[model samples]
Target: MKSDMSDTNNHGKEISDDAFATLIRNQFQLESLGERLQKIENETATMKDKWRRGDEAMRDFTVITITPTEFTLGTE
Candidate 1:
């Protein structure tokens, strides 16, 4: 129901040929960005699935719980 972006062009008044061309170009740009965002979302979902599987495996084993701030990873 709510609009995400606002359209600036006036529908009643006559628009110049150059303005029409600009509008078409902007619409294509938005389409390209939408495609890119969808691709990223798919990749992120894949990564999350992998992490969830790994966490489940780790939970089946015994682990030594420690303080968050006190545990320094990759450092002896």
Candidate 2:
């Protein structure tokens, strides 16, 4: 009778242990997903910065005009 009782308790503990393991695995997966999302966000920010710099550089450029006697440079 004692052995049977212990077996029953062990069986219950095994089920609970499996549940805990699954929970831990899910937590790790969520952490991994968060890291991936952060990396993507960083990359997107870098691309936006690059585009902004390019736009600013374009704005800084000006056109040059030349007449027979003189030359002029102007920005739009």
Candidate 3:
């Protein structure tokens, strides 16, 4: 059996079974790659949002000293 696609490659060329199968497989692979890329982008965005919220929460954080022992801590 042959697959007939009109107006392809500037001519109505009849595609053989093997060529048609390859074309279909390639299209499926491209679609799968696109889906994977979209998933990765979504995951990256979610990670960025989590990081932003974490940073904001840290910004409003406060530490209280329970014991009144003072030791000089210096950073060089």
**Residue range 1-76, candidate 3, lDDT tens digits:** 8778565662777888899889879989999999999999999999999999998777656234333354344743
Please report how far candidate 3 places residue 53 from its true position, in Å.
Answer: 0.6
Best by lDDT: 3
**Whose TM-score is higher: candidate 2's or candidate 3's?**
3
C-alpha lDDT of all candidate models, in order? 0.74, 0.67, 0.78
Pairs that collide in candidate 2 are none
Worst 10 residues of 1 by lDDT: 1-10
Error of 1 at 69 (Å): 28
Candidate 2: list runs displaced more than 4 Å: 1-15, 62-76
Off by over 4 Å in 3: 7-11, 62-76
Task: Give the TM-scores of the predictions, in the order they appear.
Answer: 0.59, 0.59, 0.71
Q: Can you list the residue pairs that collide in candidate 1? A: none
Tell me the tens digit of each residue's lDDT in model 1 across 21-60: 7777999999999999999999999999999998986875
Tens-digit per-residue lDDT, 1-76, candidate 2? 1122234435534345555667568979999999999999999999999999998777665223345346445733
Task: Please give the clash total of every predicted structure, in order.
Answer: 0, 0, 0
Shift in Å, residue 64, candidate 3: 9.2
Higher lDDT: candidate 1 or 3? 3
State the TM-score for model 3: 0.71
